[model samples]
Target: MQINCTVIIQAFNFLITYLFLRKFFFHPTVQLIKQKDTAKKILAEKLKLKELAVSNLVAKKNSDLDAFRYSISQRYQKPEQAVIQIEPNVLSKQEVIVSPEVIEECKNSILKGVHNAL
Candidate 1:
């Protein structure tokens, strides 16, 4: 088979064009795409770490709140228990009986105050 000059020239032109496009355009675009992918992976890892930190913080706060509530309940309960223990003793004290003469004197004083107000 005889080779044509036009076919060789066209093939050479295609090879040169392909090499130039790959060097200037295709390679840079591929590199940019790879960089973006790496950045996305790094961001995802950072997000997972942040979520884990938030969960740990929430757990610590919950435990602290529970401890504070327990301490407050104990503080209130001690006074309530003391008051309950002292209430019976206070109620068991004897009643005093007033003399008839003293009762009559108080009634007379009250009546005098009412008359003066009128």
Candidate 2:
């Protein structure tokens, strides 16, 4: 088979066109895809970092709340202890100071309640 000059020229033109299109179009498109992938990766990493920061803040707030609760419990415990200590002493030292008239009134009220119940 004899080689034709037109065929050789056509093959060369096709190769040039392929290389030109790859350089101008395909390479830039691939680069743009790579850039988008890189941007997505960076954004994902930033989101993870922010999530970690928020979790740490929540943990800190919970710990602070626990400490506050502990302090309030301690403060209330002192008042409760003082009241317990004072209660027995106050009860032991105090005497019932009912007068004769008040005792008679209490008896009369009790008799009235019994009569109403019957």
Candidate 3:
């Protein structure tokens, strides 16, 4: 069988044009669209992750606050040590705090047993 020159030339032209478009136009266009789609998907996922993180942080903070409130509400949590701790220069409603001279005299009377043993 003999091939026609016109048909063969037309077939060659079609192949070259298709290859050129695929290499220089269609492939890059498709790749660009794919890249854009991937970027959009990534951005959406990032936004979702950020929202979840914020919600988790808020939930954790609320839980901590609730725990703290519950702890404080449970009892007369004022420590015994605080009641015993002494501050300088304090005066009662009827009594005044004298200087160290009077304080030492009062201590001797209060601890009379220790003084006798010594």
Candidate 4:
């Protein structure tokens, strides 16, 4: 009977020790993990906001550049120079005519080629 009482006392002591360790260590470990999660969430939100602002700024700058390009093209656009023609008699005195000697030279070249083939 005495040995049964001793065993029950030992079991009760072990239960109390287990409960104390859980209260002192496990509870704080859980709280620290929760704090770390919240910090990560806040940091992610801030980075997302910064990225969105940069994207909006780039879009606005590109739009401005496009508008400037359109305005410049419209201002300088004009018809081609071919819209006007010169008079038929322009530089009538200065025009050089090819002589019959040039035509004879071309004829001699063709004759020489025919001679080589035969």
Candidate 5:
């Protein structure tokens, strides 16, 4: 069997190139990918925490509003009066008896060709 000098040189060159790439390029790239994944996980956890905090704040606000409404109803001795009045009359299910002032305003708006006051 004849041993070629070029074959040994080629094998040595391949090994050196592989080591250099592993040390300087491949290892750093792998570490950077791992760091990016860690960052994404940290951001996701923080976002979840923020979402929970916002939900808690909303729930607190709703409870406070309900308490205020209840207090208003007790003070007025009328539960229905405590409800916030809707601007658009058509959307409100409760039938409000038209006051003479409101009827006059509606009649004036209709005569003026203004459709929004109804």
Candidate 6:
């Protein structure tokens, strides 16, 4: 039950410090964190949109290339190579892509088989 001058002064000092920190330090720090979160979200959305655009462009390019190949194959029809036209359907259905080296090896093996048959 001792009410002194020092206790009152100390209580007032504590209140002022709390108010100053809340206004200058805590509020600004919280606002900065919110701003950074919003910036990251905006960047992520932009990246996703760009990725979608790139994927669409790639799909269009692939379709155009396929159309060009089909047109060329049709224009250059060889009567002597009727097997090639028939084989393309089977190869397209398989969707198998082999390297040029593998194709060369396969050609060599076919030629050897033809020679052995002869």
Q: What is the lDDT of residue 1 in candidate 2?
A: 93
On the 0 to 100 scale, the lDDT of residue 66 in model 2 is 100
Relative to the true structure, how large is the alpha-carbon lDDT of every model? 0.83, 0.84, 0.83, 0.81, 0.85, 0.86
Looking at candidate 2, what is the lDDT of residue 10?
100
Clashing pairs for predicted structure model 5, backbone only: none
Model 2, stretches more than 4 Å misplaced? Answer: 78-100, 103-118
RMSD of each: 11.5, 11.0, 10.9, 13.4, 15.6, 17.4
Output the lDDT of residue 7, model 1: 98
Model 3 residue 36 lDDT?
A: 100
**What 10-residue stretch in candidate 4 is worst by lDDT?**
78-87
Query: 43 in model 4: Cα distance from truth in Å?
Result: 1.4
lDDT of 2 by residue, 71-96 (tens): 99987774222211222353355586
Off by over 4 Å in 6: 78-118
Residue 19 displacement in candidate 4 (angstroms): 2.6
Clashes of each: 0, 0, 0, 0, 0, 0
**Model 3: per-residue lDDT, tens digit, 1-118?**
8989999899999999999999999999999999999999999999999999999999999999999888887864654332233456555677776899989986976576444444
Q: Give candidate 4's error at residue 112 in angstroms.
A: 44
Q: TM-score per candidate, in order?
A: 0.64, 0.63, 0.51, 0.57, 0.62, 0.61
For residues 1-118, what per-residue lDDT tens digits would candidate 4 score against the true structure? 2568878889999999889878998888999999999999999999999999999999999999999999989997864443233346733688656679967975886676556544
lDDT, candidate 5, 1-118, per-residue tens = 9999999999999999999999999999999999999999999999999999999999999999999999988887732333334457663787888899989986885665543332
Instruction: Compute the lDDT of residue 86 as modeled in candidate 4.
Output: 32
| Candidate 1 residue pairs that clash | none
Total clashes in model 3, counting residue pairs 3 or more apart in sequence or in different chains:
0
Model 6 TM-score? Answer: 0.61
Give the residue spans of candidate 5 off by over 4 A: 79-118
lDDT of 2 at 32: 100
